[model samples]
Target: MKRRAQGALEYLFMIAAALIIIFLAVRYLTRTSSTATDLGNSTLENITQELENAGF
Candidate 1:
């Protein structure tokens, strides 16, 4: 009976660890994507302005 309880606890711990990892990964990805989007927008704006200045 104690062995069964130990096994269950181990499985629960692993599940909790996996969930934490997944949540952190998702959070990191979202932040990175948002930052990348902002960077892309600024780069596009800069290029547009430069092109206009060049009379293109």
Candidate 2:
């Protein structure tokens, strides 16, 4: 009975650890993607402004 309880507890801990890792990874990816998007938008706006100034 004690062994069974130990096994269950270990499984729970493993699952919790996996979930934490997954959450962290997703958070990191979202932040990275948002930063990239902002960078791209700013670059595009700069290009458009430059083109308009050049009489495009």
Candidate 3:
């Protein structure tokens, strides 16, 4: 009975660790995506302004 409880506890720990890793990965991806989108938008706006100034 003691061995069974130990095994169950280990399983729970593994599951918890996996969840934490997955959460961190998702968060990192979301931040990276947001930063890329913002950079692209800023670049586009700068180009548009330049073209307008140049009479294009």
After superposition, candidate 2 runs with Cα above 4 Å error: none
Candidate 2, residues 1-56, lDDT tens digits: the string is 99999999999999999999999999999999999999999999999999999999
Worst 10 residues of 1 by lDDT: 1-10
Model 2 TM-score, all chains together: 0.98
Residue-level lDDT of model 3, residues 1-56, one tens digit each, is 99999999999999999999999999999999999999999999999999999999
Give stretches of model 1 more than 4 Å off: none
Candidate 3, residue 51: Cα displacement in angstroms equals 0.5
* TM agreement with the true structure for every prediction: 0.88, 0.98, 0.98
RMSD of 1: 1.0
lDDT accuracy of residue 45 in candidate 3: 100
Rank order by TM-score, top first?
3, 2, 1
